[model samples]
Target: MKFFDELKARGIIDALSNEEELEKKFNEGGMSFYCGYDPTARSLQLGNLFTIITCMRFQKAGHKPYMLVGGATGMIGDPSGKSEERNLLDMETLKENIDAIRKQLGLFVDFECGDNAAVLVNNADWWQGLGFLEFLRTIGKRFRVNEMLNKDSVKSRIESDSGISLTEFSYQVLQAYDFVTLNKLHNVSLQIGGSDQWGNMTAGTDLTRKMNQNQVYCMTMPLVTDQNGKKFGKSAGNAVFLDGSMTSPYKMYQFLLNQDDAIIDALLKYYTFLSLDEIAELDSKTKNEPHLRLAQKSLAQEVTKLVHGQEGLDAALRATQFFFGEKIENVSDADVASIFEDTPSVELSSEMLNEGGVIDMLSETPLFKSKKEVRRAIDQKGIYINNVAIEGPTQTLSKADLASETALVLRKGKKNYCVVKFK
Candidate 1:
């Protein structure tokens, strides 16, 4: 299939400039495209992964990707999606962030695919030593203040209580200049970003036209949201960090696994490389047999494998199975912590591990609440430790009761679980 048709079929195209010409360029299949990221965070989050996957699609279609890290722009925040202004980072921090992002970008796109390889770029390389006054006179003079004021990003900020700062207002000029620079240096003709960036991205295309008489294309993927119309990702209050140390594979998998049934088809298309036909089948299963959660599992597995690796997916699957009551013996501390990071936890001294009984230990936490509750749960066979049903309520905790190095799982009923940690 042609690239544009696949993009349309997958529902990936939110907005783009010059649809006919861009489609022609996509069909011709040898143009260079670019996606820019400002190092606002040391690690990219789930929202950024959507664009990365889109770049993967482009690369698979025989196009080159220029992954641009905005070291220069990170120093002055983009106010496109913000009500309040962004906190600017210093040079040292920006350098560290750019380096980290450069490394993370490697995990997604191929930096060495021969002629079609991805190129990691830092805009600071070009923007650093340019004379501020000269740039303002040459490039800044091209933008009309009326058009700048009319941008949704700028208009909203201007009408706000804080108002927009001069620094942020100039962000578009910097971003626009990036396009012209890339077009001159690398023959990059297309730019892709999230829907929120429509204003800033189009600014690049227009600036490219006005400055050098070159036509560049811009495309955006819609900012994904759930059924309730709340803006998704970090804005939805369920932010997942792309860095493994920040968010574990099990957590990322679980996050995708809990999507609403109504949005699975859209999410599978956006997050996974699955064909529309495959997503349609999953969507059918989701509607017919919601209980099996086959669609959700596939979404989780494909995304986790892409972000993390097959090994990470395997670990996540084992952790998921362990959560669902499959016995996992000799569980390590990292697995327990990562798997149960959000589970309610209570810390007790090592003395409790030796002297305290299960009833006493569980009673200390909000889970069991009281000795009577623990005793009742025990009597009813509703209590489990490390997924194993206890023999009786009379036994005390010992070193052997520890599922990992310093923690043991406590449960009341099937779903209620607490991680009891010993110092």
Candidate 2:
């Protein structure tokens, strides 16, 4: 399929400037395109993955992808989607964030693919040297104050309690200059970003045209959200980060796997490269047998494998299976710790276990309300020690019951599990 056609098919292109000219340029091939990522944090979150995927799609189509880390702009945050001003990061923190983000981008895009190898550029390289007066004369002169005031980002902030700052108000000018610089340095003519970045992106195209007297292109993908309209990249008020250190592969898998059925089709389009036929099949399964969660599992697997590789996906699957009645004997200690990281846990001294049977131990922890509740659950065949049903209150955790040498899995029922770590 043609590049634009594929983008439309995948629901990646929300809006683009001068589609006819861009299509012609794309058909000719070897077009260098870029998407900017601000290092506001140490790692890119799930929210940033769509743009990265878009870059990958362009690269696969034989276009050169430039992943721009916004070291210059990140210092003065983009006010695109925020209701309030962002706290500026110190230079040291911004540099650390840039280095970390650079490493994460390396995992997704090929940096050594011969001719079309992806390139990483820091906007700081050029912006750092440019003087304020020079910037005002050269780039800032192109932007009209009235036009900047009319932009959605600027207009909304101007009407709000916390009005926009001069630093942030001039952010569009800096971003526009980025496109101009890339065009001059790398022959890059296309810029892609999220729908929220439409104004900033078009400003870049405008600046390029005004400066070089040459037309450029800009495209944006829709912002992805869950069924309830919350953005897809967050869980329990925290971002689901792409860096494993920030958010573990198992947690990432579970987050995707537990998405509402109503949004799975859209997520399939936005997140995965699964073809229309495959996604259609999964959609059909979702309709016919929602209980199977075929779509959710596929979404989780595809995203997890993409971000964390096969081994990480395997670990996620193993961790998930272990909780759903799978035997715990084969799982490693590290796997056990990872799987139950969010589940309730109780730590007991080795000497404490010697003083009590299973019921007595259960009573001591928050797992059970009382000794009576423990006995009741045990009698009802709802209590399990390491996936084996505890027959009576007489049953005690023996050393052999420990999955590792130090831990035991306790289950009150099918879904509820707690880890008892013997210190």
Candidate 3:
């Protein structure tokens, strides 16, 4: 497929300027395209996932993808899609955030080789040294205040009860400047971003055309959302972060694995590099036996491997096995720790287990919320020690209760499992 055709097939093209001309330019090769990322947070969420993926596609198709880190612009937050002006990040903090984000982007796009070799650029390089009068007289004159104020991003904020600040209101000019700088210095012709960024991206295209009389292109990708129409990053109120420190690989894998049948196909197309045949086959299997959840498993596995590594993928898989009624006996202690590191656990002394019955131990951890629930589950043959169901809450702790001499896996039911460790 042609480069842009593939993008459209994958639904990555939310909007693009002069589609015919841009496609022709891409076909000529060595076309420089860029998408900017502001460091609003320490880590990028799922909303940013599509843009990075699209950038990769452009690179693979023989176009250079410049990943712009808004080191200078992030200090003045973009007003797009905001109810109120944001609190600015200090220069020290913005620099740190820019470096962290650059590292994250490095994982997605390979900048070392090929005609489509990716590169990271910071606007701070140019925006930092410009004199106040130089900026006002040169780039600032290209934008009209009347036209800027009428943009959707500005208009919505202005019409809201919370008024906009000059810092945020001038955000478009800074963004437009980034585009013009890239176009002149690096010959960057294309600017890509989210749908909400259409206004800012076009502002860049227009600025390039007016200032340099150069034809620049712009494109955006739709927001990655769940079938329920809600955003996709939240895992029970906590976001699924790309940074392993923020969200562990095991948890991140599980979040993708738990995707409902309704959204798996669309997400696979957007997130994974799997061929259409493979996706269609997975889709077929999913429709045949929705219970199997094979597609969701593949999605989780692929994404985990991409963000984390093979070791992280293995950890997530091991975690999945434990959830599928498997025991911790054959698993390594390190793997066990990596998986259940976040699940609540109570460290028990060996003597403590010896002194208390199963009921007392269960109650001590507050696993059941009450002793009565623990007794009821045990009486109903629902509670398990290690992987085997318990007959009664009165069962005494024996040597068999400990797994690998350090851990105990308790199954409250099919879904709820707890791990207890011996210090």
How do the predictions measure up, each by TM-score? 0.94, 0.92, 0.86
**Pairs of colliding residues, candidate 3:** none
Local accuracy of candidate 2 as per-residue lDDT tens digits, 1-423: 777776777778799798888777776679999999999889998889988987888888889999999999999988887778989999999999999999999999999998999999999999999998998888878889999998898899999999999999989988999999999999998999888889998889898999988778998889887666776453225478998766778989998999999989988988899998899999999999999999999999999999999998987887777778876765555656777887788888787566358887888766799999998888899988888888798876667778766888888788888988888
Candidate 1: Cα lDDT at 366: 69
Q: Write the per-residue lDDT of candidate 3 for residues 1-423, one digit (tens) a residue.
A: 777676777677887788788777766668899999888778887767777887887787788999999888888888877777677777787778887999999999998886668989999899989998999999888888999988999999999999898889989999999999999998999998888888898899899999988989898888677656765443224477888777778888888888889889988889999887899999999999899999999999988898888988986787677767766675555555666766677777677566468887888774788888888888888888767777676688865667556778887777676778776
lDDT of 1 by residue, 135-225 (tens): 9898989999999999999999999999999999999989999999999999999999989899998999999998879989999998887
- Ranked by lDDT, the better of candidates 2 and 3 is 2
Candidate 2 local distance difference test against the native:
0.86
Q: What is the lDDT of residue 356 in candidate 2?
A: 57
For model 1, the run of ten residues with the poorest summed lDDT: 229-238
Report the Cα lDDT for residue 385, model 1.
Answer: 86
The deviation in Å at residue 105 for candidate 1 is 0.9
Q: RMSD to the native, candidate 3?
A: 3.6
lDDT scores of the candidates, listed in order: 0.88, 0.86, 0.82
Residue runs of model 2 more than 4 Å from their true location after superposition: 234-238, 329-338, 353-356, 391-407
Better of 1 and 3 by lDDT: 1
Q: Pick the candidate with the highest lDDT.
A: 1
User: How many residue-pair clashes does candidate 3 contain?
Assistant: 0
Model 2 clash tally? 0
